[model samples]
Target: MANDKNNGQDNLRNAKASASNMYEEGKAGASKMYEEGKASASNMYDEGKDRVNQVYEQGKEKAEEIYKQTKEKASEIYEESMKKVSEAQENLKEYSDELVKTVKEKPLTSLLIAGGIGFIISALLKK
Candidate 1:
């Protein structure tokens, strides 16, 4: 009976030791998995940030290109408008010169035409 009790005590002690070892191994494995998961999450976050930054840079560059294009187009339009205005001014000056020359060359005919136009305008105003 004494030997049987000693055997039972030894078995119990061995079982307890085995259970403790299994618990320690499980804890170590869980800690390792947690660390790996944290590292993976950090890597994913960094990659996401890098992608966002790259997209932001591309957008900024595109906006700058658009702005430059718009500025060039506006400049071209302004130049075209100025050129048209200058042409119109030149045309007006030429017309004025022609009229002055005609008036000087044919003063009597111009006076007769002006008088006829005045008579027509006064008649319309009366109606």
Candidate 2:
């Protein structure tokens, strides 16, 4: 009976040592997993930040290009409008000169034509 009792005590001690070893191994595995997860999260965050920066640069470049194109087009349109205004002014001056010459050559006829135009405009305004 003493021998059996000793054997039971030895079995209990072996079981306790095995349980302790398994507990230590579980802690080590959990620590390794935690480190791995942290590293993965850090790497993902860096990659995402880089992508955002890259997209921002691309958008900025595109907007600048669009602004340049719009400015160039506006400049061209302004120049064209100025040229047309200058031509219209020159033509109006020439017409006025011709009209003045005609009036000088035929003063009575010009006066009669002006009276007729004024009468027609006044009649229209009354209506």
Candidate 3:
């Protein structure tokens, strides 16, 4: 009877040790799973950040291109306006010279014509 009790006690001790080992193994597996999840989350964040930066660079480049085009168009408009102004000045100068020549050729006649135009314009305005 004594030997049988001793054997039963040894078997119980072995079973307890096996249970403790199994608990430790389960805890280690849970820790490993947590670490892997954290690594995956960090990788996803980095990838998202990189994509956003790429998109920002593309947008910046596009804006610069549009700005260049606008500047070029403005310069062209300014040049065209300046050319038209120069042409108008030349036309005014030519008309002035013609008027001066006509006045010099017929000074007395031109004075009479000017007085007659002023009288007619004043009479019309009064009516």
Instruction: Score every model by TM-score.
Output: 0.76, 0.86, 0.68
Residues 1-127 of candidate 3: C-alpha lDDT, one tens digit per residue: 9999999999999899999999999999999999999999999999999999999999999999999999999999999999999999999999999989999999999999999999999999999
Backbone clashes in candidate 3 total: 0
Candidate 1 has a TM-score of: 0.76
lDDT of 1 by residue, 13-123 (tens): 999999999999999999999999999999999999999999999999999999999999999999999999999999999999999999999999999999999999999
Q: Please state the error at residue 107 of candidate 1 in Å.
A: 6.1
How good is model 2 by TM-score? Answer: 0.86
Sort by TM-score, top down from the best: 2, 1, 3
lDDT for position 28 in model 3: 97
Q: Where does model 1 exceed 4 Å of error?
A: 100-127
Runs of candidate 3 with Cα error greater than 4 angstroms are: 1-19, 108-127
Q: What TM-score quantifies how close candidate 3 is to the native fold?
A: 0.68
Per residue, candidate 2 scores C-alpha lDDT tens digits across 1-127 of 9999999999999999999999999999999999999999999999999999999999999999999999999999999999999999999999999999999999999999999999999999999
* Cα lDDT for residue 118, candidate 1: 100
Better structure of 2 and 3 per lDDT: 2
Better of 1 and 3 by lDDT: 1
**Candidate 3: lDDT over CA atoms?**
0.97
